[model samples]
Target: MSDNTTHPERCRCCGTMAVHRRLLDQDPGYARRRSRIEEHAFRAMRGTIVQRPGCTRIPVVVHVVYNTDEQNISREQIDSQIEILNEDFRKANADISTVPAPFAPVAADARLLFALAASDPDGNPTDGITRTRTDVSGFVDDDKVKADASGGKDAWPADEYLNIWVCPLSGGLLGYAQFPGGPAATDGVVVTYTGFGNMGTARAPFDLGRTTTHEIGHWLNLFHIWGDDGTGCSGSDFVDDTPNQGGANLGKPTFPKVSCDNGPDGDMFMNYMDYVDDDTMVMFTEGQVARMQACLDGPRSAIGEMVSCTPLHPKALPKDTPKEFTKEPIKDPPKERPKDNPKEFVKEPVKESVKEGPKDLIKDGIKDGGKELPKDNPKDFGKDPGLEPGKWKPLDPPPKQIFEVPTKQLVEGPVGGKQAFENPLPGGWGNQPVQPMQPMQPAQPLQPFVLATGQAPSGASLKPPVADGGGEQDQSQALLGEYAQLLAQYAQLYQQGMLDQQGMLAWQQAWAAYVQLGGR
Candidate 1:
């Protein structure tokens, strides 16, 4: 049987009947546990149990599941909700003045304050709002939305925190709550995102964040003021102060709304536990406060004990611990031998090899005043050629120009037989005055051919070739082909179980060769 209670448009909270159905269907022993809770509440109302000392601050975590942009409420909106909860729970709501005169004296401060947890369950600092993007448009009272697998976040430790889920609710449910003694995973309340916070996506009639206030009342073990019976006075909220009413009220009710033959005083329709618009609900009566206080002293005592400060991550290893290596060392060393015969290398004439040296290319490109990029065709600079030209949007106003200073600030020396720049520019670079243009140095002879990888030293540029008939395209294709062939050879060696450090070194050399051949 469907036990969900549907309310009119003004307020729709399916609290007691929904929870009763869920527990009965899911647990065999729910009835006995619920009866015990009722007995405890009854005793508290009759003054057998004392209210808790001072105010108990309950730490809260709000999970926001959004399908649209607006549903992801802002920080201010969350803060507003918390503010409203604090006001309503403590009986400090500004509208408490609107409560009927007869019911005003019995309105009690529940002495509860709600705070967003300062840290998450993992002990990391948090603002207490978790946002998740979901494809599900709305959630019924089925509780599927309480799981990460079901497009919502799993609740934090229910014993330590009040987990509130803010999302769009299906079946016109403004909100619902799991009364104490339910499964820990699904503990806490589900409030519609549109009715959650006063700001951002909050709709009319429900915009003041009273839905959370009303649902949280159930979480604290308070029953509906009108009782859950269908328009019958036999149903009781188990509180003496609240007048017997026919059923849940809608919109706003005038004073002296007599029901069930209660004449001089009428139904307390302004109570938070009743189904009314956000603006209509006003306060929780003293009898209701006693019932909720009994719950805190019984089922929910642990929530008051938890410290919401940031906790350290569970998997964080101690700094003093040493790491163990996973793989065994290679048995074979690299097979690439050092270049053969350094003495015989000087026998080759220097002039014949000058074009291969990178220094000459730089000198040739900059011999004129400054290099010019081809009219509108800026170099693609190692980017994918398959990129659609239509998608390339030019910068409206280009970034500020950076001055390229020549290599005069450097000292030249032979480093591992390759020309290396020495004495780099010092810090506080902008303080130094720009130097006059220096005369170009004579081109140096090339080093013995060895494949080089990685970037040129800072302040050096790879000069693109002068405009020739598709020479750059042909060179790029040839380099790419060679790179592919070298990769194929490496794969074959691996398959034959012949690949070792030597093969790895060969692959590195192939990459260097591609760079040298202007593959970019």
Candidate 2:
């Protein structure tokens, strides 16, 4: 029987139903509160991304993780995505076929560019993109499949590389994206194979190849043009310059749309993050460029830490030929062979070539498919930190097996989010008012629970298990997660048992404090 009480709350990194349910159960108002926090966060971050003519160029490492050879999309496809970013940010989209002749002149060109790296995050040499091959395919929206290293997803140094996971999007959606600064914010891109590029599996017009450009915009902190209201026009996207939009547009919109009486530019339908076919969506407003810049300059400034701060690369290496052969000892040297001529001595072949050179095969990033992916739905998680009685389980001793995590790709075709999830306008996440004063109490120094990296034991889900043979495994690492889960379950049971209101508040407070302390 399906466990309705525990709805697949596992971390995408590790398939354990061990994730904290607090985030899922969070009141929708939390989004509004989070947006409020984002406002101040963006205002504070804008200062960092502004690059004047001679400003430092941010160096970035791109890790291209593929499930297999066919899913191994090429280097050029990666390059194309970068090219689109440079163009979109600089407001130099190749063409505005949708723009009426009247407004083509004011198109803005925000300045940005992405390149194959000339240096590694550590001031070493590199070619910007690294490729990994994983046996896993059929990417799902679920994060568990993609996180390979940690019992959860192991990330490339989040502060340094721009990790892009390339795999077949199992679901038809162009992959989903995470905004900066959330717990999972450190995660990388998951572009769908066919949904990714304009030239390859990517289709045309809609495939003008802007899906990634749009998602990355989300990565860098830009919102859907209509402010992602998900519905309703009363909400405002918060940007002063953008005209109020009634909701999200799905199929190609004819010009002069009269919703919310927006007009002239109509719906700003050409904006990135809209549902129009790729080619139809064209520009990002100066405000959007500013917002994105603010993001790069702000909360995500770590992305710049490894960028072109240095200027050198080891482009070549020495050959392995030995320079000078060591001479034989006196006794061995006495029998010199006759040469064609003393002056024209013949050379002897040496059995060993002692040469020093840079290792060429050292990959710039983790190789995918090097490990088997934990099965899609790990059947049983042995000792779930959370979940209910007899539902989840945990891995007693963690296995050190390397894994294949889910990589994301673009959501191709006209976006049908309208059907699956409504994005009606003006009042979504973007429009939510900024309540900047939400108090962030100073972090209380509390004892931290030990976290062991483990996977789901088989039963219902497919989490990987660490093997310690038969001896009793040390489980101190289960830490805050199990406790947090237990606490939640206890509260649920207490609520159902007619616990007094004060008792419930105490339970809720204790739970809130645990999460506040980053429990699990």
After superposition, which runs of candidate 2 have C-alpha atoms over 4 Å from their true positions?
1-37, 41-58, 101-107, 121-124, 149-153, 305-520
RMSD of each: 36.3, 27.0
* Runs with alpha carbons beyond 4 Å of true place in candidate 1: 1-8, 305-520
Q: Which candidate is the best by lDDT?
A: 1
Clashes of each: 1, 71
lDDT of 2 by residue, 109-188 (tens): 54555555676647778777666666655655555434665222344565666556556655344555555544543355
Pairs of colliding residues, candidate 1: 123-311
Candidate 1 has its poorest 10 consecutive residues by lDDT at 447-456
Q: Tell me the whole-model lDDT of each prediction, alpha carbons only.
A: 0.66, 0.46
Q: lDDT (0-100) at residue 145 of candidate 1? A: 75
